[model samples]
Target: MSSPTSIAPAARLSDVHVAFDGVDVVCGVDLHVAPGELAAIAGPNGAGKSTLLEVLAGTRSPRRGQRAVPGAVAFVPQRAAIPPRLPVTVRDVVAVGAWGRLGPWRRADASAHAAVARSLSRMEITELASSPYASLSGGQQQRTLLAQGLARQADLLLLDEPTTGLDADSSRRIRSVLREEADRGVAVVCVSHDAPLLEAADRVVRLEAGRVVGAPRT
Candidate 1:
């Protein structure tokens, strides 16, 4: 495992601050995800969990502080935003994760094919490879979306409510895959209110009223 000081952070928020219309949503938080670490951000609805995620993903600039994240950051939004009704199959959707490197052509080499297959299998969605994306159930769609993010094998992975609507078995599979990704040196920061996920994480950061209160005792 790489130490926080030794390995450059996949994403780092230094004294970050965020607000909306004169109201403070997040304030003065310093967070960093080192290589090979799985960190969980847990907070209530108004605690700015998703806001921080957007900051790290570069979708939103902090009101104050610096945002440093890898160029290959993969941000998987909640399930409702993930399921695509396009005519593409699950395989096609997952394969798109590699498009950043493989280009838009379908005639990718064997290595690219293997990568897509591996990602699907990791999320236990390999059997749905041929199923149309819109045809899968909600849980199945979530799994497929996860496969797409995992396929990126990005330096940083940010997910919001990743396990929402998943069954116990499905959630376990997803968590296991994320742990494995961290083992392989991907910095993973997941925003979730689920207790099981927080317990399983390598570290948990709790927030209240948009400010980090303290680390959870668990």
Candidate 2:
């Protein structure tokens, strides 16, 4: 992985603030994530970690400050955002990531299929490709969602609580995949409380009451 200072940032936020129902969730935070770096946002519940990620992802606009992101970005929200009863297969769900490039009417072609396959393999869910997404375990579903994000072939990847509630092996696999993605020159950021994930991250941004208390490493 290249040194963070050697390359331009893939995502940057300056003096960012986000509020919900007039209550501040993320306040006066600044962040920068460079290509080939894995950054972890760690905080307790209600600390605004997920909201900060959304601001970086351009999904939720901030109440104040600036966000700059260039190139394709893939965001995988918490598992609850995906309906458990959906009838899509694992492969079907992952293939949707390519639809952005395939456009609305175009059908999936060879390259699209290859992208989905590669993503599934990276998450170690290739064997579950044909299975119904709704039938999988929480860990399996999380991996599938991550694979979907990877299928985007994005320059920046953001995830929320990916290893929450997952078994040890699942968490380990996810951590490994994150490292691999960073090594492949994708900027990766995840909101997580998991110790292993935080420990493995190249940079850990600690948040408290929506404020960044420390960012100790590059």
Please write out the lDDT profile of model 2 over residues 8-49, one tens digit for every residue. Answer: 999999999899999988999989899999999998888999
The C-alpha TM-scores of every prediction are: 0.90, 0.95
lDDT of candidate 1 over 58-91, digit per residue (tens): 9998889998876587777876353455578999
Query: Could you tell me the lDDT of residue 165 within candidate 1?
Result: 77
Alpha-carbon RMSD to native, per candidate: 2.3, 1.4
Which pairs clash in the backbone of model 2?
A: none
lDDT of each: 0.83, 0.90
Best by TM-score: 2
